[model samples]
Target: MGNRILIVDDAAFMRMMIKDILTKNGYEVVAEAADGQQAVELFKEHAPDLVTMDITMPEMDGITALKEIKTIKSDAKVIMCSAMGQQAMVIDAIQAGAKDFIVKPFQADRVLEAISKAIG
Candidate 1:
């Protein structure tokens, strides 16, 4: 993927791991944020081609941030990252405006496939 991407996760290691996956596969990580509030701000500033947002974060959670970002850019492409068994939250995210979602303990192939489906 050639698009500029943003990764938002409260866990530093999670962010790092995803970044590594994207960068190693030729995606550009334009920004990374530790909280949902920061993710919103960064989205406004960068308007990256895509966003990978974690569901649980400080200050604001991913669903709220997803809603806020949708308010900012109606066509914003966001993919929620959630841990296993968060089905209700996942449904809420999809309802709110997330274009797609991926589960944690990230798989490199799954990430790429989701990004491709979202951006394509």
Candidate 2:
């Protein structure tokens, strides 16, 4: 995973965990945001190759951020991160143009796989 990535999650621990995995595997952690609003701002500033976005967040939600990012760059690649039982919200994310999704408690393999599949 050599791509530059943006990690967005309200939880600092989650962001750290993701950054750890991504960096260890050779991806550049371009930026991290705690909420959708910040995520959008960072997206504009950094224009990372990929974004891993948590679904439920304060100030704005992942779906809304995804939409806003898409508006900014139509070909943006985003992968939604959500806990189990968020089928409806996941569907909404897909409809909103998320390239893929990863259920949380973030498995390293699955996370890497989704990013690989999406960026490819």
Cα deviation of 104 in candidate 1 (Å)? 0.8
Candidate 2: 10-residue stretch with minimal lDDT: 1-10
CA lDDT scores, all candidates in order = 0.95, 0.96
Over 4 Å off, model 2:
none
Tens digit of per-residue lDDT, candidate 1, span 1-120: 348999999999999999999999899999999999999999999999899999988899999999999999998899999999999999999999898999999999999999988999
**Candidate 2 local lDDT, 3-96, one digit each (tens):** 9999999999999999999999999999999999999999999999999999999999999999999999999999999999999999999999
Position 115, candidate 1: lDDT: 92
Cα RMSD, model 1: 1.1
Predicted structure with the largest lDDT when compared to the true one? 2
Q: Compute the lDDT for candidate 1.
A: 0.95
In model 1, the worst 10-residue window by lDDT is 1-10
Q: Tell me which residue pairs clash in candidate 1.
A: none
Candidate 2 displacement at residue 59 in angstroms: 0.3
For residue 1, what is the lDDT in candidate 2? Answer: 39
